[model samples]
Target: MDLLSLDFLILAGVMLAAGAATGVLAGVFGVGGGALMVPVLFEVFGLLGVADQVRMQLAVGTSLAIIIPTSVRSYLGHRARGAVDMTLLRNWAVPIVLGVVLGAGIARFAPPSVFMGVFVFVAGVNAIKLISGTRRWDIASDLPGGLLLRAYGGVIGLLSSLIGIGGGQVANIIMTLHGRAIHQAVATSAGIGVLISIPGTFGYILAGLGQPGLPVDALGYVSLMGVMLFVPTTVLTANLGVRLAHALSRRSLEMAFGVFLAIVSVRFLYAMFAG
Candidate 1:
């Protein structure tokens, strides 16, 4: 926790770099920060030798904490440009928030070995599907029923909380396949992520039960190290990414991020399954 400690300084630097990168990616992809933060956190947890018991929860919680700021930054630009769907946001956010809270609570006590195995399997499957071009962006929010919508949101929340991701990857695919426009789906999912992170961070903090050596100035499972180092960088860089989004081709950026996601997913699979 000491600012002058060499370990803290080094971790801060690494987090800053990852935060900036996440900003650029968010700007380009119209998603929250976890696309980049999750992978980085996984590696950080591994390096820190955090116990398997809570490492996954910490990573997920830390990713959600970063999302609080990063998603707001990404959404501001979209709201200004009228890309966000306020109606859809209102319709789904409540259920999604509830889902995130419940998911976080469950993850806090679940066995890490089970979570990691599932994480690796899902990431690998998602990556392969992307590589095959079966998961390209589109638009569709066709929830067959209100019950299904809540259930889907809950499932996404569960997976997201378990993995420390924003859930945009799955949300986007689900929405677009149902007939929602890609941009609208991206924007709305950002709103859902905001809901997920705000409640989910608190959930993990409460569930963490105050593990020791959690680095300096930490809040339960959410790494104070990552949140402090990454949040500001993410906000600033996300603004820049927004500008770039307006100037560049949105589809191009999305495609690029897709490839990046596959690479990161492979890394995650290796870290969990191979480890």
Candidate 2:
């Protein structure tokens, strides 16, 4: 395909527009926006004729790369509001990174169905909780510390890496269920995105290194083209999401996110059973 052809230009425009939406989602939801980006990137890669074997990995890896900057931008925005829990982040850092490494290694051989399963299970459960107005049901009076907390971090990182996310959905639900305020949960989730995406990106890169059927200019599974098209727009629009997040009531935000998770869950469920 001609790099400057009309068809390619149209897809490029689509990517830019998607990036803008992604940035807003990242900021508002304290996510890395991979839940949105993975499916979009999958379609784009398919249209671009990436091989079936490698296209999913490419999408996953590229989404992680894109999240690095978007997560940072979103994290900074949330941190400025004095809502972030630095202590939790500090505790989770090593475990999360280690889990990311393990997950990325698994990604090298896992099928798309594996990822979809993880997404459907987690997102579906969270969707039900948030949409049913049970988001505040306390699993504990407060978050656990020591080994248990680190285990949660590891799980979050592992799942996020597998599914190309920034770990927000898992972290947010965990925090909220432990009696943390929704605002603090969301803010802390943004920081988790930062921790997940950086090592996750490198892990995917290393995992896909020397793999076959990769697209041109792909750094391992990470698509440079997708990253290039996505980063600028996502970075520009992140602040808009942050502002919107702070303006909404906690209940409103929870409901919105719940709806979003519901949609994501249904989409993947269909893909899993019907596809």
Candidate 3:
């Protein structure tokens, strides 16, 4: 395809717009923007003539690659406001990395449906709880001790890696359900994104190595071109999201996050059952 073609320009514009939205979502919801980027990349990759066999993997890998910078920027913004939980991040770090490694291994062999199933189940449950706006949804007054919390972190990392997320959605849901404030949960989630995205990106590159059907400009499953198109806009807009998140009321933030999760769940559900 010609670089100056109308189709190329349209796709470029779409990527920039998606990057902007992704940055906002990362800030407001404390996610790595994968929930939005994965779907967008899938469609964009398809339109660009990527084979069906590798399209989903390419989307996921590219999303993770893009999340690295965006998550870092968002995390720093949250940290500046003193919203981040350093102790929690430290405690969860090892288990999360281990989980990401396991998930990356699984990705090398798993089918696309496996990821869709995980995404739907996780996002759907959290969406229902937060959207209902009931105190009864609170599972405990505080997070579980030691091994249990570590296990949760592992699971969060595993799922996030498979689905190409920042692990924020999983962390935020757990934190909020255990009585943590929405702002704190959101801030902490940004840190989780940082942990997940770095290893996740490399894992994907390793996973996709030597795989057939990968497109041009791909290093394994990651599309370097896609990363180039997304990074600048995503990084520039992430701080804006942080400011908006801090400005919102606790209840308002929860509602917003819940709605975002609901949309993610629905999108995957449709793909699994209808597409």
Relative to the unseen true structure, what is the C-alpha lDDT of residue 8 in candidate 3, on a scale of 0 to 100? Answer: 86
Q: TM-scores for all candidates? A: 0.83, 0.95, 0.96
CA shift of 195, model 2, Å:
0.8
Total clashes, candidate 3?
Answer: 0
Between candidates 2 and 3, the one scoring higher on lDDT is 3
TM-score of 3: 0.96
Which regions in candidate 2 have their CA more than 4 angstroms from the true location?
1-4, 135-137
Encode model 1's per-residue lDDT on 164-249: one tens digit a residue.
Answer: 76767667656656666556766677666777778888888887766765655558888887788888888888878777766656
Candidate 1: segments with Cα more than 4 A from true spot: 1-8, 45-52, 111-145
Give the local distance difference test score of model 1.
Answer: 0.71
RMSD of each: 3.6, 1.8, 1.6
Give the higher-TM-score candidate: 2 or 3: 3
In candidate 3, what are the lDDT values of residues 128-147, reduced to their tens digit?
Answer: 87778787878899898899
Worst 10 residues of 3 by lDDT: 107-116
| Best model number under TM-score | 3
